[model samples]
Target chain A: MVMDLHVSLPRGLTLANPVIAASGTFGFGPEYSRYVDIGSLGAVSVKGVSPEPWLGNPPPRVWETPMGLLNSIGLQNPGMEVFVRDDLPFLREKGATVIVNIIGHTVDEYARVASRMQGEAGVAALEVNISCPNIKEGGMSFGHDPEQAYQVTRAVRQATDLPVMVKLSPNVTSPALIAQAVEQAGADMISAINTVVGLAIDVEHRRPALGGTTGGLSGPAIKPIALRVVYDVAQSVSIPIIGMGGIASAADVLEFLLAGASAVMVGTVTFQHPGRMQQIIAELPQVLSRGGFRGVSGAVGQALPAASRPQTRGGDL
Target chain B: MAGQQFHDGQVDARIVRREEVARDHVELILESPALARAVPGQFAHILTPGMLRRPVSFSRIEPDSGRVGLLFQVVGEGTAWLANCQEGERLDILGPLGHGFAPPDPSRPWCLVGGGVGIPPLYSAAAQWRESAPDVIIGARTREWVLMQKDFEQLGLGVRVTTDDGSWGQAGTVIGPLQEWLEGHADGQVFSCGPTPMLAAVASACRGRAAAQVALEQRMGCGIGACLACVVPARGQTQMEYRRVCTEGPVFLAEELIW
Candidate 1:
């Protein structure tokens, strides 16, 4: 029983599998190459890149919770120029399907990064990051407001012909509204959702554990919340959804697919087990077959309301 | 990239031995051939029941035996769980990761300074230098808290033990003995580990007197460089830059650190 795991998105982007390495968790490709085969992943979404270099937050950046991780890394990167010069060549050489996750302090900065990535070899798509909770300016702020989210998505859409994915934050009251706004503004896909905003206190120090004080919670703790957001956003938008939040196993991937995510990104669990993504990809087919599904497309949106389920595309067994 | 010869990968190492080294400090020996290439200050990212892997430096690495030792104090839920792990149980570990201490110049007099839970890597360093044993100083809050003293002495290295309550060999911190040692051997090199405050003081004491490299401890997400979580401020070209403690170092030159 051969189970097909391929996924196809808008703008001619097609993945060999539905498992992608989430942005920020997997560095700019080289870090995990020793532990994981970079080319085998469906796609490698590099860390969020800004127009200029970002130094990120201070010390004590990550704290462990029960089945969760809270981090405030603040989207630190070497800027677009260095990324295009140093990182892109490496990923291209590795035969990886690259998804550049773009971020900025303003709408122009997001577009500038998107435009810079234009015609870049091996880049399959652009994931617009408007939902990073760590940064003080222009991150989650744009994601919370539907108008700002639409504007950012529109700018990135104009800057590049590549498929654009607007990452949604779960920190808002209505992530569905934000998803609808981005879909209206020409977003080809929606990656729902980003980490949930949270905090941890150091009782000994009488202060917050993270350098950014508050961080985005990830890992098994946010799976249910992520499914809810992906399910909600799937119902609100016509574009496909890339689901992520504490995704640890192949079974979790199917759950996200059922909740309306066409593909899933694996993050925090990679820290605990670096080879988890590869393991998930290998295990996905077996899990999918066991769940009475022939392929990933068959499982996508299976749990959604009958009237709201989007038309399944790509490989269906 | 230089001096990093260890091939890092995930291994399910079976616990070969477990010993109570000190009060609340447990030393577990695991059969991990992958860590055979590990140098003095390199560490292993061990997965406990917790979400994040704990980065514990190598206390002992015996390549011939295919066994590595981890000496850690039971601090939180993670270490406490690690302490309860019995012999013969397998542990999921990723290592021997990170750059370690550079080989000390044999011509110059060198010393090993360690405090509290920071003595493990220094022990590994001392074992490597058993042929030409350097001066060793191990400090703790109390007499019972001092660790690996007999292990150093057993290796035929002279060990200096210090305690805060004056119940041990030297009263107060390792600074008093360290200052006297620096006065004696001004051209010496110092490799120190333990608490951040002790490292700061060691860095201060060695200024203009002896060269020093100190191992740092920080809460890490991914014990690899990807997460950018375990970072320490370092002197960069124009301004201070955050360096990953897991990759750039758990071991760094004292002068290179911002504080």
Candidate 2:
């Protein structure tokens, strides 16, 4: 209570702690609510939602890697329509700040999904999932290209009054460039980074273990890469950054914050234990007090030296 | 068992009895009332030593005594640690997860086929329908690998055993006798739980003739529906979309299975 874990991001989305349940891992708050008190968390990003109910990838969709997991789930979700009718109400009842993650195969699909959620009562913000394949341009992911990232982010930003946080994929060469493009396109916040692409094969069967052949890797293996992405992107944009990708412990939260993330999201680590967020939240004060920080925001972007700080970006950042 | 595909209640279950079937396979009887809620095909997500929970199927349930049985194969470091756990020790289990098998009509011949590690759940399914005298086929690599045959036989259910090396009742796979039965029988249904190859063979044999439900195995992340790790390709009304094997089913209608 004395540590002041409160973090006020763009669009007035406030959190009780820096550790929020990442999308896909939390599943709109209902799944983990039974094991832990979900209402106490900073925020919970619901699973990636599409225009229609997506069936996702075939069997063997998930493969286990060393200290990580590769999943080609293909963003399996109940469509935006069904989510609004059935799932969103329960999330609202939980009283936790909800970040609805939306994805699309086309720019119109992203915009349409965003617009449909504009009038929703419980949603705190929209996290655009540009990692989805851009069907308009031969199935290349929108987040991989700078122009597509900007166009998709702009479409979603224009479609909704809610704060837009673009969740960028780490597959790109320099996430800083994409972060700059989204910030220029009116993105209120940046959630870097999404899963890194990876592949796993079944040696005994002499074939791919995952039905999708390849998948997005998430977990402890990608933590360093994600930290670098957050560090690089923080200097390039003034927008609040919600950092994630294998964040599991209180110490991990501190690392992301110091690496220039205003708040952090716990993604794949929750799969191991559902109530892990509670432990991290409880232990966060000890971590902050140990590091001589007064609050969660006190640690954001502290790793960057004075000379490395952005010269032009001057607001609350 | 919790009346849905996903439930958050993680039960602390104590081991009441431990039966070692083979070198790596162990059958443990856990005492938990929440387990009484579980049906035949449903499984429990048990916390192992690793970073993820292990999915173990429910072998039997004594509802009145508030006890359930679990079958696990110690194939790795995580399960090996779990298998070594002695009686009176406790396990954190999230149950009664996933959809259980719904038995076909009793009037029709119910063929319960199980191979290798898949034999456990079939025992529970057979015990439930024992009054109807279901035909239980237990298949293994050899007679030494065959398990729960006596359990099924004690219920007076017709038991047929098959082994690959022909060290048991029938030679070759269980599908041989299963195919023979499916071809002659008019009113019958097949419920299979076994290796992927066995299930696939049964599926192909029973295709349009015998209605079947097969239990699938997958490497799961969160035993709850949150992680889309446990999924199988199942055809919906319009398209062949992926269905979550963990949530929508561990048991799916054989017709909808892609392979």
Q: What is the lDDT of residue A252 in candidate 1?
A: 92
Candidate 2 chain B minimal-lDDT segment of 10 residues: B1-10
Q: Candidate 1 - CAPRI tier?
A: medium
TM-score of 2: 0.92
Query: Model 1, B35-142: lDDT tens per residue?
Result: 867999999999887899999999998999998999999999999999999999988888888989998988899899999999888989989877667999999999
Per-model TM against the reference:
0.97, 0.92
Candidate with best lDDT: 1
Superposed model 2: Cα runs more than 4 Å off: A132-140, A307-317, B1-8, B183-185
lDDT of 2 at A62: 70
A-chain TM-score of every model: 0.98, 0.94
Clash counts for the predictions, in order: 1, 0
Superposed by TM-score, candidate 2 places the C-alpha of residue B154 at a distance from the truth, in angstroms, of 2.1
lDDT of every predicted structure (CA atoms): 0.91, 0.83
RMSD list, candidates in order = 3.4, 4.0
Where is model 2 chain A poorest over a 10-residue stretch in terms of lDDT? A131-140
